[model samples]
Target: MRVSREQVTANREQIVVNAAEQFRRRGFGDVTIADVMKAAGLTHGGFYGYFDSKQALEAAVCERGLAESVAAVDAVRDGEGGEGTAAEAPLRRFVDDYVSARHRDAPEEGCTVAALACDAGRSGPELQQLFVSGITGMAGSLAGLRGQGSAEPAEDGGPDFATLSTMVGAVILSRAVAAADPELSERILAAARERASAPVE
Candidate 1:
């Protein structure tokens, strides 16, 4: 059966979206093309029509995952109510959302960086580059938030890389620690949020 170009485009996007969610929920190594195709409600044989190889599908998934994450950060940084919302409001929203237990428990819907950075570390260069770009972009957004509220010229006049790292690290650690020590997990998140909100020197 011949698929219309519009339907083909939609099908391809569906596969990538489903694959991204699966990769975020499970590690990249754990999700197979069959699993992704099944999740997308498509036949396994049709997978090759959209992607030349699993690696190509993975690259597509990586880009989609990173795009989802980047969009979330952008929404927070730009504020939902358009201009005039307090500059600090969006940053606060991001820190709170990013470090919350909800985010920790919901890998499929959360930041890809927190969900898959460790997995990406061992993946191909293209995927790793996507991870790096996602992290860098996120940090840059947070740094811009920090700069708006700082009295000084923002030190080197860039984003606060440490705070952004701390937020991402805290989410990963919190998820790891949550299964064993719930209190500690919450404490970790709280500390990261507090530290992120603190005035930069």
Candidate 2:
């Protein structure tokens, strides 16, 4: 009953994808390897076949989540008439998606940085590095929207890191009280959008 290499790769990817979504929904400490394995439709005994340990799986999950987030931003940029399109078009798309109600309600498929930042502080270095890379990628994406080749300083004094942090922080705050304070949640997103879209000063 040996599996083919293709199937094995699919299984491993499935495990990572599912684990990433679950980790974003539930903190790392709250999720167990057995739980992830069961959710992935594989037996607990087979978990080790794909990942050496839960920590390794966490790292993989973080990697996958971060890649997806950056890809999402890149897709928006690519759609906006290649590199010559107005930077504001991609920037608006990024802000809209980042603070949207759909994103706020969908933790399993949303940005991992906003979903798992608190947990990342207590996690191992692998997950921490993944978080840092994701944040940097996001900042770079926003910087690109400004026609900058890198996340270097803008002549207008707008910092990409500041924009990235503000967006992530807004989402975090929006989600924190979304259930009990729906109006505040909506306002949070709207306010963040307005601020993010304003001219960087």
Candidate 3:
């Protein structure tokens, strides 16, 4: 039977979502089209119907994950407000969520930057571009938060690049060393949480 266009779109989105989860959990090189299809509960042959190539699927995945990450950060903005350290409460909550043991152990649901930046660097231009856009969106959402309180925007009006770097880098380092030294992993998150959530100067 022929499938409806809506069904096809839903199926394609399902495949991308599953692929994103699997790729984040297993890494790009370790995942395959068949694996993504299987994770999506669709037949392997149907993969070509949705995407032209694994890279295409990855681009879609990155798009979805990055958008969600930015949205998650944007959601925190509604919670902004308090005096003193309390003023940083919203971003602090976000930082804690991003740099926690739960996030470290759950790559499939974590930040795309932390999970796939290294792979994207080698994956080719299209994927790299998606990473760039995604990272920019993330930073934009974060930059929006700074505008909420007394902290004025930097001349560039960009996200606090240092804090963004620390947040992503901390997760990456913590995950990288997690298998070898669990203590270090927790400490890494702790240090990053402190820095990433600190009140702006």
Query: Backbone clashes per model, in order?
Result: 1, 0, 0
TM for candidate 2 is: 0.87
| Model 1 residue pairs with clashes | 143-159
Ranking by TM-score: 1, 3, 2
Per-residue lDDT tens digits of candidate 3, residues 1-201? Answer: 999999999999899889888989988999999898888889999999988888888888988888877778887777632222554556666777888888889999888888988888888897888878888887877777666654444337776677788889999899899999999999999999887776666
What TM-score does each of the candidates earn? Answer: 0.90, 0.87, 0.89
- Between the candidate structures 2 and 3, which one is better when assessed by lDDT? 3
Ten-residue stretch with the least lDDT total in model 1: 146-155
lDDT of 1 by residue, 1-201 (tens): 889999999999899889888888998889999999999999999999999998888777777777777777777666652233464556666787788999899998888888888988888898899877877777776776665444222357675578778888999999998999999999999999887767766
**Alpha-carbon deviation at 88 in model 3, angstroms:** 5.9
Ranking by lDDT: 3, 1, 2
TM-score, predicted candidate 1 vs. hidden true structure:
0.90
> What are the root-mean-square deviations of the candidates from the true structure over C-alphas?
2.7, 3.7, 3.1
Error of 3 at 142 (Å): 1.5
Regions of candidate 1 where Cα sits further than 4 Å from its true position: 81-88, 149-154
Which scores better on lDDT, 1 or 3?
A: 3
Error of 1 at 192 (Å): 0.8
